[model samples]
Target: MDTVVQERLSTKIQKAVRKTMKYIVDEHDVRARRFLPRNDLESILNKKRLEQLFRELLSNEYASDTATAIPTGSDTGSAEGHDSSIEIDSAVDTCVKATIGTGNVSRRALLALFLYQPHTRLLSLYVEWLTSGHPRIRKPSYDDHEIPCDKSIPFTEGDLETLNIPFTNHGYIMDYQTIFTPMTIRKFTHHDFKTRDRLPFLGAKEKIKDGSSGTVYKTNIAPGHWEFKTSDGRFLPENPDTSMVVALKIFKTIEGPWGTRDAKEVETDFNIERELLDSLRKRNISHRMIMLHWGSFSVRDADGIPSYHALIFELATFSLEAFLKDEECYRIFTDKSPVLAGLVDIVEALHCLHEHLGFFHLDIKPENILVFVEPESVHSGSNHEEGRKLIWKLSDFGLAREKGSTRERTGHRLSSSYYSSQPSTLPATRPAGLYQAPEIQSSSSSQAGPGSDVWSMGCVILMVLASIIEGPEGVTDLSSKLEVFFLNAAGKQKLFYVRNDSHSW
Candidate 1:
């Protein structure tokens, strides 16, 4: 008897739910077609009308009709029980789910109904019910409403990561209402670098090198003659009055080996370089290091996405590698003293890096060591002083690691001269005979540390000194000399002796 009554009640409830939804579709659903926001459509439907519709559908007359249509306690067989279940299923199918699945009602329109009346728990419950795959709720098609897109800023998922905000993934469009602002959206546009009001001049630039990560440009930051220091321990302005040439390293705004262009990577590079520079600023040892002005900034590309980071550095005359390759530059080698002096300054920078900053310059090579040209004293200085006067400083900390940090292999191609023998989890990629420490070569599990840097530095110094002593032959035979030192028994003894003697010196 109770089963019969419950079936009759369920049938009536399904009918009421269908009628209520149809009325809502007819009235509120009309405004949705005009592309009004979900809130406005709900306001048009109003709370009073929604409650009134439910009230009308559950009236006493409907209950009386439901009770009269099904006789209770009159049938008692398996066939009768099966027939009642079929009737209830049919009612739910034809009546309860008739509106949502088989109609032209947009998913946006239906979703909007739930999103309205924000403080209510109904929205969350409605979403749960809709997704539950209940027999009475049909799966609705969501293709009717086109997502509104901002054509001006066509940023991708990667580009949007630059904002550093949390967002929900909804296909191509993001749904982060609480986090996004008008200012944030404007940042996604490419209008920042065009102004001469704040940013430094990037025009009339000579392109230096365009690499996978960033582009480097040679630009004049100011106009004047410049020197790293004056004789009296005061720092000189970088030729602020006349042709202050500097190197501008601009990070790639788009297209870097797929994931390399992500904002996190860009931010990591920015923070690491900025913080490292910040920690090193104004120290007495900074004189021996690459001079990076606090002028670090960011810029958006044409697509309104932050594409690159801009940092201003004191321009190196050329790399030490370039200095060696020059035939004319080698004329100043009166002995090994010039190479030794430059090596001392580079070692000092490394000392500061290791002892003071707790950092290890993982990538150390002749190319990473920049040679700063000092202006001649206008009185035609002697070759001896000038030869030993070449200032060498460390640059390119892109692969640098703090001391005690685990070694992770980088994507950069290693020069044979610069490769360090550290056990890297990354495969031995592009291996050729070169200058890695014995520990690195013998075991793939050995980690890189300060000693690894010392080894690389020694190799660089050896090559430079060898080139000077052996004249043209050392530069040409650099590859063979490196191989002999790392591979030959006699060369190893000579290397050990040099290492011991260097500590005494």
Candidate 2:
């Protein structure tokens, strides 16, 4: 019996090691003429990212399993499943921490190994067992314990005080929740852009975009003088009143019993946005960005459960798509020079994003670009320079990622199709974009770098130019009519440039 147990343990360890290595290599250099001299594999694998990957794997594992899901409401469903999920989460967390503590392999190294081949059946089964929600053996004797509630959950005033998060019981979604802490709270300060008081303590007036994860609201912030409780418990007034409004983005929280199941994924998406915003801020590249987040706040639902999240951002007058649809602006965008000038501004912003910030706005359609029409144009109905003198900023960082990320990511993350005809409906199998780069469809590797952005930009410029020259109907028809011709011509031009000049496309 002892020998059998030992043999099983040894086999498991060997299998783990093999899976890790295979995932890391991922067979990227399968066509190498000879073995590469230098392979710095660790460059891609780092401790922080490795830990993140582990958390993701664990979250996915939990999400995929049906048994461990929490009950939907307070009155209905089984507490056993919720308890089981909690147990599994705790166990997995402990296991991962212990594994990382061992330091036999770096987190990045382990991640690379897993990514190379993914996990095999036997190893996956082993992991499933190791991270299972409950024991296979059911207890013959079980006792019922009272289900925990808001009052039952012991939280001290000192706890909130220690965190320095004010809880006015102001009926906000995030204030009442015991477990959650908004990611943006860590990034910004109280007085930063005067966002602390500017955020509304009340409910949203109207919802703008309702997505799978959350809703965007067209709400008003205080923009006026307000007082807040300081760490020393002093109520201090900051700034004078100004009537300024902002866009408030709110996320749905997992509520009832089953809510925790989906909340993790929602929180993950929210955190990604927060981290991206933090990166932008750290790089000091917020000037031309579409939306700048001031801070994050939590909102409480009717049940007084802190489930909803809100992020404050500068409100745009309108989207570029809206601008294009306006009959007043058609004359200005119709011309090449001013439209090209606007494109130059966009390019400058893109340069700041890609070159300086090392990020790519993966989803770069007209709707994602917001236009702040010049205040001077408020009264003027002029069709030339004044009409075109608008500022464009890129918004919606939901699908954005750092440059040179792996191409393993497969999804159509665009907001909505601008054209009436679907690109997916077209005969040729291509990426879901009229604005998508040519290489994104052709390249097997996942590196959609600055080049992809440039390609998308070219498409956007063409769309605006086409709309100017051909009209709105022409904008839709432009790609289908001329795509093949341009592609063929561009291919020839690429060869010509490569042959004649030192440059390569």
Candidate 3:
């Protein structure tokens, strides 16, 4: 396990135990008309005992033979040939025996065991077990035992000024207010922007894009529900009623012929992206050409384990590739000048990244160039046009590195076999060979720098120009003509590049 993950899990467990114990003591006070001393409760419900009990329940519930773990209220069906109720009862019985012992257990201990349903994820099973008339303790009302959401922490004015984040009604800064603490993602649906496929089933995540490092999804955050206090202690969005849609990028474990990339490497990638974004935020560099990173949070699995670390970002209407391919959008860009201007905006953004920040966005391509179309313009016909307003921004910095970093370019490529196994409809996981600089294509090269990024940008420009002049089909034809293929040492037909026979562009 990654150290970060271990720390988060330990913290969550400790918090859960404390909350359960608190609930038990509160219930005891209500019943006996007298408060129990902290030491008395400690004798029955120490952190270690409750922590072990919760862990045992988690292990039993998530066992391979058991029903699905962490029943998120959606999966009510049981596993085939498995009686989950029986398993739950047995696990609960063993936990009660081991933690409380067979002797006369105190009412506080019974309440403590009963109140653990929410923490251990046993939910109704724990309630049902308690109802079997073991000494007839009165069942607590649902409202009495349910855990409340964490209260939003107000940001001191000094804190905001120190971080250089401004107080503004601008959508980007407003969205930033919702992310100071990691907000829990309750439900989200994924949409694949490239294929534009509607999900077959409802309530499923619409996967916008999948890459070698992570997957991105579109999700909504309720403004007031996730609102933050300002420097003066008032919530930024006084209204806080509306919902804002944002992009959720979740980092995943990468497996290839090289070997399986572990959680630590994935965590490192997550941290690098966060640090880069934070640097941009602290400098108050909210450029229109750069995607706004709201914040980052972790997603827990059924067993309450932090399965994936995710970042929140401003969601764009489309990618550059998707925009050019859509017939309606192509018609909107008929003037060609605006298309060229958008490309220039991207260039300026790259300049900010490379020159201002001293960072290299090694993985620059069409798919990473996000296009934000005004909502009003999306439905407008070509005849009604003041022309569609488009904002292009650079995104997906998983392969980015600082100017002089010594880290190897492990993310540059995947095994040929791994690449081949991906779905045909999905966009290329990384920059296609046609867009890669010669240095990136050469396995012998040690590193790619700013010039390499410029080379990639030039390739993007050619594709954009081709789309404006010849449309999507013309871009396809240009790609086929420029593409040169070769086999790697593994006898796999893997390499793709645009250089001529003499190795010169």
lDDT of 3 by residue, 132-224 (tens): 343322233233122111121223455434333334412332222222222222222111211111111112245799755688987655333
lDDT of 1 by residue, 327-421 (tens): 66776645557567888888888887867765666667777788876764552456544533577888776656554443332333221212234
lDDT of each: 0.46, 0.46, 0.52
| Stretches of model 1 off by over 4 angstroms after superposition | 1-204, 207-213, 222-241, 253-260, 282-287, 290-294, 301-304, 332-336, 376-388, 404-446, 480-505
RMSD vs true structure, all candidates: 24.0, 24.9, 21.1
Model 2, 1-505: lDDT tens digits are 0123223333433343332232233353221111100012232233443344445555545555556445566543457656655655565564354334343322322222224333333223324433433353221222212111123222356543432324542122122222111111222432222211112222225566643335677653332223345789754433224333566677665443223325545656676676677778777555564466766755444454445466666677777666655665676544456556666788788878866776767667776777775554353465445543567787777666654432221122222221223222111123335565544442333334456567777767777776677666666666455433233344422110122222234
Q: For every model shown, what is its TM-score relative to the native structure?
A: 0.46, 0.45, 0.53
Candidate 1 least-lDDT 10 residues = 179-188
Between candidates 1 and 3, the lDDT winner: 3
Candidate 2 lDDT score at position 285: 53
Off by over 4 Å in 3: 1-202, 228-239, 256-259, 284-286, 300-305, 375-382, 406-432, 485-505
Better of 1 and 3 by TM-score: 3
